[model samples]
Target: MSIPGQIAAALSLWIDSVANTVSARLERARGAQQIAISEDEEGALTLRLVSKASKDADLPPVRIGIVDGAISTPLSPEWSAAMKGAIVDLALRPSRFVFRPLELPGRAVEFLDGIIRAQIDRLTPWSPAEAVFHWTPPQPIADDHVELTVVATARAAVTSLSQALLDLGATAVDISTATPGMERIAVHHQRIGGQTGSSRLRFALIAVLAIAGVPAILSIGLGGIVTDSYDAEQQQIQRRIAERRAIARGSQGGPGGSAIELLARRKQTMPSAVMVLEELSGILPDHTYATELRIEGDKLQITGLTHDAPSLIEILERSPHFASAGFFAPTTRAANESGERFHIETRIKPQFGSGT
Candidate 1:
């Protein structure tokens, strides 16, 4: 079989899963079958306890077993206390610690991290890299895999919660800063096969019909306006064609520049240049004067001089109408009438002719 076929075959047996977190106590039991199972229970469930620590030496050991589900005994007292202590320690830190049902703890951890980071940035200035997160596995499964659980809290929060737990006669130990764990089971359900191709064809046909109906529905509702809009567009296109042909007729020889030149000449003949010059004159400062003005396409480059080059660049940068303006190193001249003439140049965008 091909690699993809092998993967697909494997996927067929693999069950999709979601991360789950259970904040519970572990009980030390002698026998493996310590869980209390009820006759009324219909399904299977696995229970696990995870301990988060600041250091390896401070962590407490937890044991788990299967027993009758009807017996309502807390899993592990020593481990449960340790887990509670972790929660208390997490709560005391500057980090906001939330003990949520581990149903979707992976997503919960992600959202909590963002919330804590934003809160920390607002409350105190700190770098996220300097922050450390220490986590311990629930139980080591050989050397390669271990069951781990994590609680995300800020350093400040840990300190606060630790002190509070201490007053309550609980010895809160520091563990890892950030700990995350996942408990996922590959649940198998009876695979019932169904027709796949027919469903795909039906979905495609429904999508096509839905898309085709939009233009038809719009045209029907705006029938009169649609006719007027089509007529206007046709007229505009015909007018442009006529103008292009006339320009092409004139540009028969001598290296043609029909499309761009015609447009440029039309723009140059327009009365907007005088208005733009007037606006520029009003905005120009006392000492600055335009020595040369060049207009290319819709760009206007003005070569001018100001006594202070840096101040001129600052003024241009602050202007709302101009997007970006840079000053070139000014060329200094001998003491002319204007006392050491320094030439500077700047560029600005010119309002373009409306393109159809």
Candidate 2:
């Protein structure tokens, strides 16, 4: 490989190694407190420390002691005195520091009390373990002894743990509940707290948009009313247009008003047809039988039977009232009567009858 390529490969490997180490440590810490509860292997869950105390064969792997009330342990007494404020709460013993890892059982509480008494006996020769271990509530003792609560257990254990931690050169000891600490450091701290704010803002923006949508829907409903108004206006305009067109058509021309004009024209022409029929009746020779009369436009056709066709023709020709009358169907033998049947058409001119 080239020099640059080899260097890149080395750097990648180094980065991978660091990432794996950090991930493994995080997983170990997450399981730490729960390990002791489920198993007797205390060291697996123990917080690793930087030891300054010389190793001694007789010392137990872990020990316990207690303190009085709350106390402050300084990283540097000079700076602590200079600042003159509480940096953190901690407990101390000879070469050990203590911390409250989690809540302890009642047996653990008695154990802590016994350990503190032992510590007091060892450190101050004049005080007996029982005398140093004695604790009384501020109020008068209701009974000879008051029950030791978890509060006492936590205080005693945490103080002793802090002192034990001091032997290992650990300047600070932290106590945490297993569940809350896991949630706080492991779960919550792994996520971005600021993203939670962004999510909330997004939720609020969606709510605003949803609320704004109502006005748009209302506007659409209002538009429907406006549209209906527009449609009604259009219908009215159309009705007026149709009415005006009808009026103009009625006044304009041929056939003054539809069927009325036709009826009037028929009335004028029908009187003449009646007079022609009357005149025909008078002019027809005897024994001439008329059976059918039909009118086509201005022409009238008469069809009937006649005994003498020549006489009928003579009667028609002699009439000055008739313009021209001619037989269309000449006489032919009928079934009941062997008589002549004929059809005659005539034009009724104005002079055909009494100036009609």
- Tell me the whole-model lDDT of each prediction, alpha carbons only: 0.38, 0.41
lDDT (Cα, tens digit) per residue for candidate 1, span 1-356: 67567444433322121101111111112111111111113222222223333332343333232233221334354444443423221211113332221111121232333323333333334344433232233343432222333333344433433343344333222232322233321111111111133344445555675689678868787997888799679757865775676566558734566666666545533335565576568677888877776655434566765544445556655654344555332233222334213333444433334432
- List the candidates' TM-scores in order: 0.21, 0.23
Q: How does model 2 score by TM-score?
A: 0.23
Quick one: best TM-score, which candidate? 2
* Per-residue accuracy of model 2 over 48-145 as CA lDDT, tens digit each: 11221232212222222223432223224322222121111222221121111221222223343333333443333324312212222112223221
